[model samples]
Target: MATIREIRRRIRSIQSTAKITRAMEMIAASKMRRAQERDIASRPYADLMRQVLAGLAAQRQGDDDIHPLLVQRPVNRIILIHITPDRGLCGGLNANVNRMAVSFVLEQSVPVTIVAVGRKGRDFMVRYGREVRAEFTHLGDRPSVVDILPIARVVTDDYSAGLADGVYLCYAEFVTTMTQRPVIWRLLPVEPATIEARLEVGYIYEPSAASVLAELLPRFVEMQLYHAILESIASEQSARMVAMRAATDNANELIEDLT
Candidate 1:
């Protein structure tokens, strides 16, 4: 058993840690509000893009005119767009994502290139000396589309150029203030079911169907990357907030027990 003085000393250390965590929690909470707002605002555009793609796909199905984005090819080289936090103290958010990535790599028998976004992913990849093709960071406080555009372009270009057979994104999808689930989402060969689901609602396409699809396809892919970045950042903050809150609460409980 530890003495009261020892307990007090431990408590003091925990208090200091709690202070940092609390600050991080406050910061994460503030950013979460902005992120959630941006996500909500972008929903309409995503919906619209999906609808337009579905309509175009339907129109072209009769002619057997398929876009390059809709074709499935022989699997060989794959690229993973990994999203993690720039900073630490966010619990196992990064670790969980990395675990899923490891599983992804294990399940498939092909060469993989990683486009690691954020410090956590980059740092983790460096240890294994894996092929991390690109890295983006310093965007956690407030990530913008422009911040992620280069990486998105590279991945899309690789797929289009046949450098990579498929592209997948690993991210933590934001559920609520306290819950985030790691997920792997397909980025290339856009899922037909997604288009079909969106097409259930009627939408009028501007210009010709082929023309609209030609434009929307690329943008849709870019937006998927952008949206994943936003979701991951938001999820990071929420996880930090919840983790810090738990630490703070535990500290208070210890103090109560001591008194």
Candidate 2:
């Protein structure tokens, strides 16, 4: 029911939108490559750290000798660390993660606290009336280990002090440049079985087993949190790139249909 002139004007508007999305897609693609590099580069160190800690845990005599980081406790207070993009135009990445966080809060039996590492998640949790214990953002596309330490410390300290019973980290796991899946991973109360599954066994420790664990266990925890941030950023960029391409495609299709 629209005139040809009106349709042509609409097409011009869509074309402009398509150009913006195209530019965004290119920028996101560039960032995604850098992020993937960082993720790949750090993976080996993290894996080796896990193996060393697992071997040390195995060397110990009894259950009580296990590191405090590996202890599982009753669910009294739950802490969720959510990693999301500070900005939008990333398709459903932010929405998907926030939905999971809200669902977790509603489903938990004990007190639930959210530690949001991105602005998007923080705003959503606060608007939805979910308890946000802590928030960090403005880390930019490329973040270093020191940037996320504050967030990691809060959960680690709470778990160590017996203030929080469990800790969960929510982020998107990278599959491919075009496909990313949101994942909820258990961060604290590291299970021996899980570690042992991937663990390389029968390694001699240089120092006392106790000393090795005392030092390495904390590093493993920090590395896990750091890598998680990388994964989140990569996934966000990938999702954004894919989404923008789709938008541009849809716009082009509409232009053709109108013509």
Candidate 3:
């Protein structure tokens, strides 16, 4: 059994840890608010872009020309786009995402190549994934498309080149401060339904609908990825903030009991 001195030492260690966590929590909380505002602010532009793309896609169905991204390819090899935190200490955020990604891999029959976007995802896929094609790391806080563009382009390029038949992006979709759910979103061979829902507006194409789609499709994919990264960063901050607050509360409770 540990003596009172040892217990005191342990408490002091945890106290120090709690202090650090509390500071981190405050920093993350401030960043989270900013991220939330940015996300909300960007929604209108994103939605409008989606609507425009959808209309373009719908109009192209009747035309002879169609964008390559909309063309369905035979199932052969697959690309799994995985996203996770660069650091730890935020409950099971990374673990749960990893679990879902693993489950997805296990269910797949075709050969898969992983394109990991974070250290946690990269490490987990390296250990577990059947095949890891590429790994990216060191994505700092407050990421942008420029940071994630190269990775996204690689995945899309492989799909376009017939190297990968399809692409599935996996990430933790933030639902609430207390809830984040793992999601496997299809990225390649863009879903028609997804386009149809937003094609409410009509437009007159300058060159052609197909030409417009060809240019817009890749940008859409890249922007979507950027959005996901921003969301995950915000979710990480929120989760960390909550976790730290709990730790501080527990420490306070222990101090009260001791006194």
Candidate 4:
């Protein structure tokens, strides 16, 4: 048995909550659009860069002078660069990505260390008792290459120095407004796709193919990391927008029922 005054107060509280969620939905929508645009825009460049690296790798497939980054070695230890959102409220995006990483770590025979890129991933890894090599956070919605350079450096340096024999990157990839796929990509021992002889065009390198590849390998890693972050950001915003919209709808439904 509820009085009119109590019902009115509860309704007011729910309405206020609805207003907040509606505002969040709008904000997330705006961020989602921008994030999607940036993610899409970077794909072309990333693909082109991958093509060029593949061409270079194809040219020096069996050469002993191949870039260090392209050198494959026995698996000793594994490093996973796990990327997730800093905050929650994004449906199951964070959980999905974290679960994927956990599964990956469990499946691996070698000892796995994490390079956590966001607060959520870092906290999850720490709680799970995983050895976190490095933690990077506070990368806003619009992070540039400069912001991601340090992370790239850690992965590249560790791999080059033989600190880790294998490296992987895990992130939530933006597929659609309603879908975010958690994907794990091998980042070390750069496996470039072989190009057909007929498909390869003859182009002169600035100094030598080896020199160009040596310089390009690091840049390629940096670009891949930056692009992955962009995808994760887009996924985060999209999930948040959807989740907030749902929350607002639920609040409105509750308001109607109470009235």
RMSD of each: 2.9, 2.4, 2.3, 1.7
* Clashing pairs for predicted structure model 4, backbone only: none
Per-residue accuracy of model 2 over 32-73 as CA lDDT, tens digit each: 999989888988888788777767777673756767777777
Candidate 2 weakest lDDT stretch, 10 residues: 196-205
| Candidate 3 wrong stretches, greater than 4 Å | 1-14, 62-64, 196-202
TM-score of 4: 0.95
lDDT of each: 0.83, 0.86, 0.81, 0.90
> 112, model 4: CA deviation in Å?
0.5
Model 3, residue pairs in steric clash? none
Model 3 has how many clashing residue pairs? 0
| Candidates, ranked, TM-score | 4, 3, 2, 1
**For model 3, how does the per-residue alpha-carbon lDDT over 86-201 read when each residue is reduced to its tens digit?**
88977888999899999998898998889888899989887763578888888887766678889888988887788988899888887888887888988888865686455544
| C-alpha lDDT (0 to 100) for residue 103 of candidate 2 | 82
| Every model's TM-score | 0.87, 0.90, 0.90, 0.95
Task: Rank the candidate models, highest lDDT first.
Answer: 4, 2, 1, 3
- Cα deviation in Å at residue 161, candidate 1? 0.6
Tell me how candidate 4 scores on lDDT: 0.90
Worst ten-residue run, lDDT, model 1?
Answer: 196-205
Off by over 4 Å in 2: 1-11, 61-65, 197-207
lDDT tens digits, residue span 1-259, model 1: 9998998888788778778767877988998888888888888898877777777777777556667777779989999888888887788888999889878877888998989888888888888777998888787566677777798788878887889989999999999887899999789978666774455656566677777777888889888888888898789889988888888888777766766
